[model samples]
Target: MLLLVAAVGILAVVGFVTFLKLSPQSTPISSQPSTSTKEVNALSLYHWWTSPGESAAINSLFGVFKNSYPDVAIIPAPVSGGAGFQIFPLIQSLVNAGEAPDAFQMHAGYEARPYYDAGLLEPIDALWQSEKLESVIPKVIRDMTQFDNHYYSIPVNVHRVNVVWYNQKLLKQNGIDASRLTTWDSFFAACDKLKAAGVKYPIQMGPTWTASHIFEQILASQGVSFYENFINGKILSAQDPTLNQALTTFKKFLSHVNPDNSTTVKDWDDAIRRIIKAEGAFSIMGDWANGEFKLIGMKHNTDYGTIPVPGTNDMYGLCIDTFQHPKAASHPTNSDRWLKVVASKAGQDAFNPIKGSIPARTDADVSLYDDYQKGAISDFNKSTYMYPSIVHGSGMPSSFKLKLNDIVDNFVQTQDINKAAVAIVNQIQSTLPEFTKVWSLE
Candidate 1:
């Protein structure tokens, strides 16, 4: 609680700080849109995907959207930092000022709750029915789009959150049997073997957000029922054994990670680079990191490979990315057009393959996707249990998640399991009122 209060205080004193986002194909800092501005033949799209692979993927979708509607220009304003961390507050300010973009990147599920609760977003139920999405998109994904009995967002791609990416060559050289590492205990034993063989940092991680991400993976590996309660705001007590146990496991995970902080690793991609260079053995990042590996010409199952964050093997951890319609959109028609392309089979096929995610629509052409994505599609189909990701903003309130970043970061430094568990429970209690959306992920 003190952590958030102190953060709010700093923001109040310094005023709003906007990060510098420079791009040849981006909106300049001087020309940020205003609510009362007249609608042009342009669609202002706000997102936070500025990385090499991420940028290419979004641009591919832009090309698809353009082929159909070349008249409607796309103004890409990508605010890049900490994944979505730096963009969230800026978007909040814009939305509060009624300057919301025509359409912006929104993670499906509770991440879109505040907008829908405040009635700032327009539901797209008509599109769902017209496009026959009900039959094409999976039920779990469809449910993620709906809140208060209306669909508010259109998911473009789905990322598996519980993936543990590692250098396959390193494990083979170390004589560790990768196939047998099916549970956390066995996984840690492999790490132990690597450590004994002079691999100082068996795991590589970057920044606080990455730490929170791996922590969520550990929590999800606790099983679907416990994780479902976690996202639904049901983990209310600090004494909850499962919660505590997860924190303990996360502590062990941090011990194996690189000693360098952000200055050294910088971001999640850097950690994957460490694995590629054989400086580290593993990285617990989403499949987005696969895009980076591919960008560098690394082949799957040869140079690197992934397994479900140990103990989460048949489970598909959800990190769905969607676009929403704002009630005060400047170019309403363009927004609708963008949503259509986002939901289209062609657009998804172009975007997700380069983006390292599976199309939300189950009927996508699998041949366009690589082996990792093909396998992900198979896993998405077989998994009856889908867990929402906390670090990625698909689960819990924004308040809870903001506070959680600090708690987990502190735990990484202190390795204090009990303290992290208590702090997390307290933050959950304080943010209970904000958790109005009830998730039915069983």
Candidate 2:
């Protein structure tokens, strides 16, 4: 009987061990939310790259990621609206609500500084170093991602801002040679000729960010370093001669624009249409504007041609769309891994072509691009003068951007050149202190 009882006990012990091995174990339930350490099979990305072309460009990176991490799935949650105005506010709300995405697009500028300062961003400095991103990317572009010796973002492209897109048919009809108009004086001369040739609006401009972009281009072409220092608060005097010169030049340029521009135009699309129909002779805009031109099947350099803003000597202002990893405990490992792929060489090759910007990587082969894009790439390669876009850089706060917009709107209406210039200077003086204080906190 004792032997039989011991046999039964042994069988029961063995059975229990077998059951333990075969049965699914319950995961430890903690009062704290579960953190995911499992290999990340999915990720959510928030961005404003909703345009078909932009989406196509972004998908290239997605394709590469899938190849590298076959198990990972990238869910792109695109938010539609103007980049600075609509999308950023939405991101701010999400961060406040503790529902930020795994990663999101950010412009490499003082604008991104706020998010970094808020402790919402995960620095990818180590990943950048490990990937040897410096070897691929230009120093100017790489520097834009770094703040205080650490990288906070991955640069995807370099936008040439000070470009003038002109209507070729109109120029040919007017017997005007674009090549001859290389200097500011010659550019203004062409504008005058276009105006005299019964061109309704020799130059088209709207009341949106494009206006400020044009202003920045003019300022940079004149003396980028001076404006850079002015924006950074290193130059506080409003009456600085360099600034006065820029303002004076801007006033002259404004004179050549459509007189009824305030009532006539609404946005970039409007300006593009006017230029396309030869209603306007030229539009001063960034290289990204080429996408709109191409969308309409306009033959580049034949239907239209691109040139640097007059007076600039092979200078290109950088406007980069970067992705920043948001701090998330549940997906930290995956987020870090995904960021490495973003800054990788494959990412640049896939992303820039469709996005209508040159790769931020200096080593990128741009042979696949069209003539206009190739022109931009060539200029970028040969560029010695590199500056940040005033629209993006200028460590000024969002509130300041709004204030400047108001100032610009008023200036545009009044057409009082001196008063307008003074207002701009005064606004800078008032806003510079706030930006300085915020930047100093770093």
Candidate 3:
């Protein structure tokens, strides 16, 4: 059975390589060549975008694609979870069994390396060249989309991960000056005051990913140089003094989170909802939470307000939404067709406005974006300290990420700074064997 598995794997690699060499161009949007409402049958797409706001944004893209490829059936398999943690392993299983979806969502960085290296992905260099992506996509993000010199995915939107949103009413009612709290010291002081004013949970929180999400923002908040150093593997362990401080501070911050957390409200949207309703003072989440507010017709700055995670004003923590093609896709042509639309300016314009994320395309219709998005776009252009999010699949591999999530979740539950710091180093050491070649942990 082991031999059979190895043989199958080898064959898959050979087949994919040959296909890469033979395929001259990706299935362009013009492939259908007709505007008839003929069904080309179903194509399964797996993603984790079941939230109200997420669905609206994704459906916007569907509306565009359906107009062109009216015959091709597009089946959506949306799982409910932030960061697709529940769906990542499931995708691996489908790939292993040669039953992969036509196309699936992926983070366009080291996270895609394992699948690409395993011959489970279809290269889209043809599509990139035909679409002239180099001229439009930012060089930094475009570079991350490639593996082994081939582009394999299309980035749709970019979400800022290091944002703190608060109910404006709550802030005013509690005599809090949101603008003055630009550092952790000031932020925590405000949290203290909010607490004294009988604000039970000043900061709304969700489950493991939410905790890990805030931790990364806090880690980056220390210093962009330090955050970049850690992500680049220049800082070897969590035992490092700066990282220790961040971890200890993380433990301190947890006390402000609502005690009726995770068990009652396990979704980030729920946490955001609490903030919007004036029941909670704040929520540290990605800009997608802004989309949730927009979905309910809530106005920004009035209903809710946003600030960079304290001390991260000059930094932009990015969480890019990208999609990848599977080598064993039952509908490869349809998959590429779908991706073509995702990479187009029109699709990005339609999608990002409803998604509360900025378009990945540089030429997107910025006029169509809201105030929050306009602010994010301006920051994306100006921020000197832009970095991909560690918690959101841009900074680490699956195994290491899973390990980090486990440690952080445990730490959130226990509030043990020393143990958490030690566990981080230990886990990284164990994970190094699988990642040393890819990571620069010198």
Candidate 4:
């Protein structure tokens, strides 16, 4: 039965990919009204939400959309990657070919600006006012969804990136209280204790992007003020002592990491699997790890425990998932319909619980969310500082992001702190234009 179900799912995703090749010549009436009996209207939805929990969450939102517009079918085009690295480039290619999906998933901040600047995106400010989203969504989120005072996309959820997940049994066996890991000094000490207790890979991480994610968290741990300065360009990588400290600290972290699976594991969930099997003591990852945990029937605070990554208690690393309408959408009305559903409170309520993220809406019901989500919500509402995630395409431009990922990946493999620091400085020195452009847009 599982195999049969898996086959059906694969067939559905395959169908969506096939539809992307249907050119104007193939569908002569593609421009006609969706409700017209002569035309079959379909909305193509592209995203990386292919995991079990994410699939279920998206289905919940699609269910609401389908009920309201029974005549329209949603084509799901999901791609796999740690951080949409594999899928986003494909999305760019589709845009270049004028075959963009009706509504596609993207990060909320500077990530979407390149497409917007190229005149590939269509603004949804009219729907924003019509749906009265201003009352429900937070002002910061509203600001994030806009470029040049025009709302271009609707944010669906906010993912906190600096979460540390741990195997509760391993920690207990090692006589290390999880609460003591609130700072780097304590965390390293705990790693030592876990090593002494025979726990391998006390800190588990995946490939390229995961290393970047950890690097960002280490920078955040320096303090909110320093993080803001660093990301905002007030501080330079080579000139700032704190930046050097962060790189050095991250390099030290690699020593405790299990080298055996560093190359073998490529997905974030794979690292979570190691922690689940008790082979690793802890993993610093985004809250989405909770979704994977639930997929395998692991209960939070029981089989696992979570905390803010060391020295980041009052800070939230933002990774918002949003949907944007392309100017070249074949079915503009259908795209609007999809966006309306995604931006609605009902949509957030249906999707966020399963996706392991807090609703972007400030007015969402807290009771519907799990304990971790509720905690995220509470922190988001009153956090001392909120910073965009560098690894998730918000803090830096796409060009700088790719370079930083390459640097972090190399650093992870070589564990050469000085070389990594110089590489980062050189990249930042050369790619300041890209970074500056993104910052100015904000």
Estimated TM-score for each candidate: 0.89, 0.81, 0.88, 0.90
List of clashing residue pairs for candidate 3: 40-71
What stretches of model 3 exceed 4 Å from their correct place?
1-40, 436-442
Q: Per-candidate RMSD vs. true structure?
A: 6.8, 12.4, 8.6, 4.5
**What lDDT score belongs to each candidate, Candidate 1 first?**
0.81, 0.68, 0.79, 0.79
> Lowest summed lDDT over 10 consecutive residues: which window, candidate 2?
1-10
* Better candidate by lDDT, 2 or 4: 4
Candidate 2 matches the true fold with a TM-score of 0.81
Q: Write the per-residue lDDT of candidate 4 for residues 249-365, one digit (tens) a residue.
A: 898888888675457886777888899899898889899888888778888888889999999998889999899888767567789899999988888898899889999888888
Model 3 sits at a Cα RMSD from the real structure of 8.6
lDDT of 3 at 128: 92
lDDT per residue, candidate 1, 217-275, as tens digits?
A: 88888988888888777898899999988988887777788889556877887888889
Report lDDT (Cα) of residue 43, candidate 3. Answer: 59
Which candidate number has the best lDDT?
1
Pairs in steric clash, model 4: none
- Order of all candidates by TM-score, from best down to worst? 4, 1, 3, 2
- The TM-score measured for candidate 3 stands at 0.88
